[model samples]
Target: MKIEIGKDFPKFFKPLYQEEFELFSHFETTAGIPTVLFAITTWKENGKPNVCFHSWSCFHGDKTAFFAVMGNLYQHTHTYTNIQREKCFCINFLPISYYDKLIDTIHQNDLETDEFEVGNFTLSQANVIHAPIIQEAFINMECTLKEVQDLSGAGITAMIIGKVEHISVDEKYAQGYERYGKDGFMMLIPAPQNILTGEPNQSAIASVNIEKYD
Candidate 1:
């Protein structure tokens, strides 16, 4: 026998936090998707540096260009507004060691706040864009805003596509295989619900481990 979930929010679904289901669909916990974790850096209109700890995104390219397809970005966020006004942003990838620092930026973020200072990070200007970059990051991808869409048409979140203009990698991680294991990339493991009992679980941070190369 197999358990089946439909499009509607599951009645048996439980929320791990207040407004958890209100902010995210029950399907998020149902499927418990995992995605890479990174920081989206931008300049707030107030001239303050902003950092948005983010996930639910993918990167790809064709022969002509590359793109960063960022999903589930809250429309109310400063990062969203900054990107809209500035037309650019920077994606910074750090190891798990910086997870707590990144989280601090989330709590300390205010329109007047310098998020880089909140996280005890050094701010560096991006090469091709006006956005700020985290100096401690292993990789920094400077991007120009390409498009923004309200995929659900709910006006709550948006899918933002950014054309990757430039990329800078730490010398140590420039090697091919070095971009794995503890020092490589951080991942966000969405909270999983017990399908049988509909019990909510806690989300977790993870590191990539190279099991095999094929």
Candidate 2:
């Protein structure tokens, strides 16, 4: 199916900004970019674990990375405080299938309760970090906060980028016994008449194995 070009995202090709230029190459990362869902639950005065998660783009094709904070620090946010105190967080690249559940979690829920428990998602300890990982997430990117730079320019969110250390995936997405990209891996195929036609353009999100293109 030909993706008819309707009204283009007017902002896609606008004038260049310093912030846009810095992160221009993020689209070409070699890692499986799971729109990260950050869960905060420590509840520290400085490190209060707040159960707040959002969709953040993966950076540098690295599994372990920091939350997407590409502007200024906010005045009151459970996410910010959690990042400030904990210094380490887990990046669960949730599939688009869990969109509704994630959206509900992002929306203001209970102040003292965790969405993980409320949402009925399996709660597991991070392999190398101190954050919670949604067991249902196909590929989990465990990130350790390395640096918090203040990119307070015109109107940008402070960038909270970090480095990756360890990563884990579901057995279904794993190849053989130790490698990623198994038969059950989900994939998201772009709409193309050369491939998909009248049939449902169904694709698997977790099936995108990084080893295939290599």
Candidate 3:
């Protein structure tokens, strides 16, 4: 037997359908999807450095990238405010070993404490940007702020686009870079579930083959 519930469906089920729709929307938006994470570094007017973890970042063009910062939550964050003042920042691609520290930086709210000290990470001077790069990171991009879009009206966030000035990669990972596009990079990403605790996981690295069809 086959039953079709079209526009003529009973009114009694309308509320149930609406409730399920909202739940689906929430889950789709908030579900922990795997994304490449970067630690962005900015410098204050006094030359103090601040770092923030951002998973909502991606390459925008051949020499540009964009990232979103939660305006409502990080309105007073040093990294957000500093970037506005300095107009430059560094994006550091951290390894899986720093996953725990990266999570800690996200939750930390103290503006006075430098993230490098708090996370126990060393910083090196960037060749083109005032902001320093993480010494331990395998890759670092020095960028200048190209644009800042106010997305607060739609969602309490701001989209920051930057022009990549320079890119530094560890020599070990740089060998035969053309052969391996992104698979050669070793970085942490969100996991579907924890293997040990069965909780929402956070750190995992996987490689996938790129298939092209003409």
Candidate 4:
């Protein structure tokens, strides 16, 4: 038989942290979806380089244009405000090895903090945008803000879309299939809750493991 999860919050679903439930819906843990992790670089109003280690986003486009649809960006984050004021940002895709460095940026991030320094990253200007990029990233996509929407209308998080203007790929990883293994991309595995017992599990950082070609 199949179990049914209805619109009402599941009584059997418990969050690992109360604050997490407040910031993110319980469904997040319930679904435990995984997404690509990347660093969003911008200039804080104070002129310090800001790096937001983030996920919950997708990228796609057609012949006309491409877009970066970033979701669950907190309205209060400097990254959000910076994008609004600067009208641009850069997305840097680093490997799983830099996960710890990225986490350091999260802990040390303040209005005046130079996040690049916190992560011991080499900063460089984007070729097309007025934002900063991480030189270590295998791929860097420069984007201009296209739109922002309060998808839930709850005044908490937002879905910010950016038009991809240009992409810079590291010459070493330019070869096809090179950007798919352990040194390629990082992923975020959401904390999963035990559906039957309501016990919460820890979130994890992961790398892609290719098993097949299709």
Candidate 5:
């Protein structure tokens, strides 16, 4: 069965482009689903600097966040420090197919260690920031922290709202790219879902909503 939704902006359902689409299923949606590793580097409250590697992220569209933290805990995060000082960050999303390299980046690399050097990845300077970009990944979002909300005043994990400064991606991930289309990119849906329905609808629904506000 097929549901006729908007195939363009201001429509109810959005058709997925081959490269830049995710699904909206009850079990697993694309909004906040994907495991990635990023290098957390900080300048410092003092005059020193440091960096570490983390394997988690729950970001939002430059205004809200998808993070969930328990209690007050903000001491040893290099990412948080960088954002606090520079007011910017770059999140690089990786495909789970590169699990091994992702794992390599999750360890306690030194302050000046480069994850791309250890992992099977490439680094490129971002379009709008001084931070490096993951050239091998499917998506890279350079964002500025608009706000950081501490839920319950517990600093364990603050919901960071970032304004997307810029976005760079592979041409293959383009929405109209035929290669990542239904039969093109052999990727895991990441859940039990309708391959055609979920992803396409996500783009469609989002497009419709954007039009409503615009």
Candidate 6:
């Protein structure tokens, strides 16, 4: 049997009317949301350091980037408050070797806990900013806050835009950059998945070669 809906058929017609979909649930069905995991470091007004794992981030322009932080949804969160006061941060791009540490840091909720000490990571001073960069990371970007935009009407989430002032790469990775033939010398990019249960799928690391087009 063959059935075809012609042009006369209504575009809104559905076989099941009760099967309504919800917003933000498309993460389960879609793929290819590149997750570049990094540690956002900031300093408090009292000279204390704070760090947190941020997977949702992207480049906005040649020298600008943005990351979404849900600090407005909760009180006493150090990442938002610290950035608000300091107006600068360092994004340290983590490699696969730091996967365990990243997971451990994500589970930590104490605002007073220093992630560098807890994750067994070292901090290196940024050249252009006061924020400390993760010494173990392969790449670091020192950025100054440029703008803040409300992502949601209820103020659940806000986007933090920053202008990258300086960038640093490890020496080994720097050599690998020219050769493009180093083993395990790539950044870790996880696949998007359910945020609550941390289940239903496995994450992946993405690495690709650049192909120039004419």
Point to the candidate with the largest TM-score.
1
lDDT of 2 by residue, 69-184 (tens): 32233425666667677786666655445556655766645557566766567877878878777788766766677767655453334466656667788776566432333333
What TM-score fits each model?
0.98, 0.55, 0.66, 0.97, 0.52, 0.68
Rank order (by TM-score, best first): 1, 4, 6, 3, 2, 5
Report the C-alpha lDDT of model 6 over 137-187, residue by residue, as the tens digit: 777888898877676554545677778888888787786543232233234
Candidate 2: regions farther than 4 A off: 1-51, 61-75, 153-156, 176-214
Which segments of candidate 5 are over 4 A away from where they belong?
Answer: 1-75, 176-214
Q: Which of candidates 2 and 3 reaches a greater lDDT?
A: 3
Give the alpha carbon lDDT tens digit for every residue of 148-172 in model 4: 9999999999999999999999999
- The order by descending lDDT is 1, 4, 3, 6, 2, 5
Candidate models: Cα lDDT each: 0.94, 0.50, 0.62, 0.92, 0.48, 0.61
TM-score (C-alpha) between model 4 and the true structure: 0.97
After superposition on all CA atoms, how large is the RMSD of candidate 2? Answer: 9.1
TM-score: model 1 vs. ground truth: 0.98
Task: Count clashing pairs, candidate 3.
Answer: 0
**Highest-scoring model, lDDT:** 1
Q: What is the C-alpha local distance difference test score of candidate 5? A: 0.48
- Give the better candidate number (5 or 6) by TM-score: 6
Task: Give the 10-residue window scoring lowest on summed lDDT in candidate 3.
Answer: 21-30
Question: 72-148, model 5: which lDDT tens digit per residue?
Answer: 22434656666777776666655444545665755734556655666756667678875666786567777766777
What RMSD, rounded to one decimal, does every model reach? 0.8, 9.1, 8.0, 1.0, 12.6, 8.0
Candidate 6, residue 62: lDDT = 39
- C-alpha displacement of 81 in model 4, angstroms? 0.4
Candidate that beats the other on TM-score, 4 or 6, i.e. the better one: 4
- Cα distance off (Å), candidate 4, residue 115: 0.7
